[model samples]
Target: MNAPVATSLLHPEFVQRPVPEALVQALATRFGSQCSTALAVREQHGRDEGAIAAPPPSAVVFAESTQDVQDAVRLCAQHGVPVIAYGAGSSLEGHLLAVEGGISIDVSRMNRILSVNTEDLTVTVQPGITRKQLNDAIKDTGFFFPIDPGADASIGGMTSTRASGTNAVRYGTMRENVLSLEVVTANGEVIRTGNRAKKSAAGYDLTRLMVGSEGTLGIFTEITVRLYPLPEAVSAAVCSFPSIEAAVHTVIQTIQVGVPIARVELIDVNSVRMVNAYSKLSLREEPMLLMEFHGSPTGVKEQAEMVQEIAGEFGGNAFEWAERPEDRTRLFTARHNAYFAAVSSRPGCRCITTDACVPISRLADALLDCVTEADASGIPYFLVGHVGDGNFHFGYLINPDSEDERTRAEQLNQQLVQRAIALGGTCTGEHGVGIHKQGFLREEAGDGAVQMMRAIKQALDPQNILNPGKIFTLQ
Candidate 1:
C-alpha cells in the first residue's frame, strides 16, 4: 500500500492534472447536452458550504441515471482523473471541493424516488433525491425519513457523510437508517452492499463502509434507507434556562433517566438572538432547549411531563408548547436555519463551524469548555446542538478576508477538537472527516487505525481517482 501522504490540511497539496482533450471529447460525445465545461457550472461544483479554497473541476457531467454515473466514472478512471461527486452542496466539511481538477459528476438530476415500500417501512431512491423531497413523497403513507441535517441535503450526500441531526436521538443517524446501497466503485464496477432484511450477519458490512466513505470508496448510484411511521401525536416545546450549564445538565439528566425525546436541541443565548431576528420569532433570548416528542397522545404527554420535571431540577422555566403544525414548522425551521441565522447576524462574515460530540456523561463538561473558549476568543459566534446525543457546534463567525481572524478560527476549532478527543469524543459527530478534520481524525483514531483505512483506500482505488485529497491522502 502507498504510504500515507504527508500533507497539511491548511495548505493541502493535490496532484492536479489537466482534463485531457480526448477524455473531455469522449464525455461530451457520450453525454451530449448533459455535459458542461462552463465556468459557472464548474464554479458551483468546486466548493461546498465550508470555507476552503480549491480549484474547480475542468468539466461537469450531469448524470441522470446510474448508467450515466457508471459511464462517467469508467471514462474518468480510464483517463486516471479524479471524480468528485456533487449532491446538494450543503456539506460543511469541504467534501465536494474539486481540489484536483478533473470531472465532477453532478448527480442532482439523478433524483428519483424509485420505490416506497410502506409495508416494509423503507424507500429506495436515486442519489439526487433530497430528504425533504423524500418525506414529501412519502408523507401520505404515514411514514417519513427522519435524518434532517438542517439543510435539505440530498439523501446521497447525507449517506456519504453518515449524517444525523435533531431526530437522531430517537430515530438514529444515516448509519442506522440505511439498509442497502448501489455503489459504483473506483474501477467502474457496480456493486450492491446489502439486502432489505432488517438484520443480517452480512460479510464485511460494506453498506456501513460506503455510508460514511464521502464518495472516496465509490459513487453511490441508488440508496435504500429505512423509514419510520409518523408519530401519532407530535408536539414541540421550548424551555428557557437561567444558564447554559443548567440547560446542558437538564439534557444530560433527561437522557440518563430515559424520556424517549424525539428531538432535543440546545440554542445558546447568542444563537437564540440570531434566530429570533432571522426567523422573526419572539422567543426568550437565553440558553434554551427546543424539544419534540413523538408517541401516542398519552405517551407523549407523559414524556413531556417527565422531561419538564427533569428540566425544573436544573432551573428550567415553563415549557412553551407548539401544538399547531404551523407553529411547530416555524419553530423547527428557525432551528434548522441556525447556521444561516448566525451568518446573517454578522454580514460579510463566514463561520468556522465545529461538530464536536462527547459521551453523555461528559456532554456538559465538553460543551461548557468549548463554549467558554470560543467566548474568550472574542470572535462573534452562535452555538447550537443536537445535545440529546451529546453533539454540538459553535459557529465562530470570522471575516474571510481577514487572515488573522481565519487563523484564530482554525485555532479555536483545533482546540475544541482536541478537547473532545481527550474526553472520549469524536472530532466530528455527524459531519464526516472531509478535508477539515483530516488531522484530527489521525489524532483521534491513531496511526494504526488510519493506516488500515488508507490500506482499504489503496486497495479499492489504486489510481486515487475517486475524490482524491479527502479523508486522508495516500501516495
Candidate 2:
C-alpha cells in the first residue's frame, strides 16, 4: 500500500525513448517555423497544474489544423517516439506531463468554432477551443455549452478527461455532452466516431471510449458536443451551515428529494476563508453551499424555495441571493477560483489534490471521516466539491521541498480514495486517472478489468507512442 503512494510521489522512471535526431530534423523540415526546440517552449509544455515533475519534452509542435496534427503524429510514429497532446495545460492530474521523453503536440492554435447548429442543439468545434470561448461565441444564439470545469480548459482536453463541473449534476459530463469526435489514430489515420444524431444504434460506441481516454488511445481534432439553451430565468444563492456534515446532509437531501438544482457546490470553512482573503469578499466563514437554479421564473422560485426549506432543516443560514447576471458571475467566479485561492493562502506551497466521489447515499459517510482525518493530519488544506453529484476534492497544501509533507499528503489521499472506492464510487470524478491516480484506479477497477483496458490500449496503440506512461503503465 505504501509502495504505491511512494511510486506516485516519485517521478516515474519509465525508460525514456530518445527522440532521434532524424525525427527532430524531419519535424523541423515539415513544420518549418511551427516546430520549436527552444528550452522555454519545451518546459512550458512539460508540466501542468499537477505537482508531478518530469523532464520537458524534446520538442513542441504547434499544430494549427487537423492536417498539422496528423503530420506531427505521423512523423513521431515513424520514429517510435512518444506524443503528448497539449491544450490549455490546465489539467490537475498530470495528464499533460511528458513522462517518457517525447514531443508535445500543442493544439491551442487550432481553436475555432467549426459550426453551430441551433436546430440540432449541437456545436462542432476544433479541439483547441476553450469552454469559455465556446460559450462566448454561442451566447447570442440562446444556447451555451454547460461543462464548466472551473478553469478555461480546452474543449479537447475536457473531452479527453471526461470533465464535468458545477453544471454536471444537471447537464451531465463530457461523456454525455460529447456526441461525436474526429480523432487521429496512433498510426495517423483520421476517423469519425459518430454523427451529430442524439441517439444511434452504432456497431460500436467509440465516442464514449475516446471521450475519457486521456489522450492515450488517440488525438482529438474535431469534437461535436450537445448544447443547452440558456435558461429563461436563473438564480444563484449561497447558504452557510453550522458544520460540514450539515452542509453535506443538505446536499444529500436536496439530491435525494429531486430538487433539479442546476448547480450545487460545497465549500468548506477553510476554503471559504481562503476565498474571502483571496477574492476580497466577506462570505460567511462556515461550511456553505453555493447553488444555482434555472427554469421558468416560477420553476426557479419553487426550486430555490424547496432547497431553502431543506437547508433550514440542516441549520443553514438564510440564502444570500445573486439574481442579477453580474452578481451571479461574481459569485460563480469566486467559486471557480477556489483552487487559486487555496494556493494563494499558503505561499510556496504545492497542492496534492484528491478527487474522490462516492454515491449520494454514502456522501456523508465518506466525507465526514475524511474531514476529521485531514484535520488531524496537521496538513493545511481546503475542501470543495460539486456535492450535488457526490463528488468532492481536497487540496492538501504542502511544501515542495519537504518529502515528509508529500508522503503525508499522499497517505491522506490514499485513505480518501480507499474510502470512496469502498463506498462504491470512483477514484476520480471529473479528473481522469492520469499518472497521479493509477494505483487507486487498479484498486477500483480490479485487475481483470484493468487487463481488459490494457488489451484495448495494446490493440489501438501498439507502439505506445500516444501519451505513454499515463493512466496505467503498459507493463
**1-475: candidate 2 lDDT, tens digit per residue:** 0012223564455456788999999999999999999999999999899888888999999999999999999999999898999999999888888777899999999999999999999999999999999999988999999999999999999999999999999999999999999999999999999899989996989999999999999999999999899999999999999998998899889988889999999999999999999999999998999999999999999999999999999999968999999999988999999999999999999988879788988998998999999999999999999999999999999999998888889989999999999999999999999888998889999999999998999899999889977888877
lDDT of 1 by residue, 1-475 (tens): 3234333435556557667999999999999999999999999999888877788899999999889999999999998888999999999888888777789999999889999898888899999999998898889899989998899999999999999999999999999999999999998899999988889995899999998999999999999999898999999999999998999999988898878999999999999999999999989989999999999999999999999998898999968999899999999999999899999999999878879899988988887887888888889988899999999988889998887888888888999899999999999999889888898999999999999998999899998889887898774
TM-score of 2: 0.98
Best candidate (score: lDDT): 2
TM-score of each: 0.98, 0.98
Q: In candidate 2, list every pair of residues with a backbone clash.
A: none
Off by over 4 Å in 1: 1-14
Local distance difference test, each candidate: 0.90, 0.92
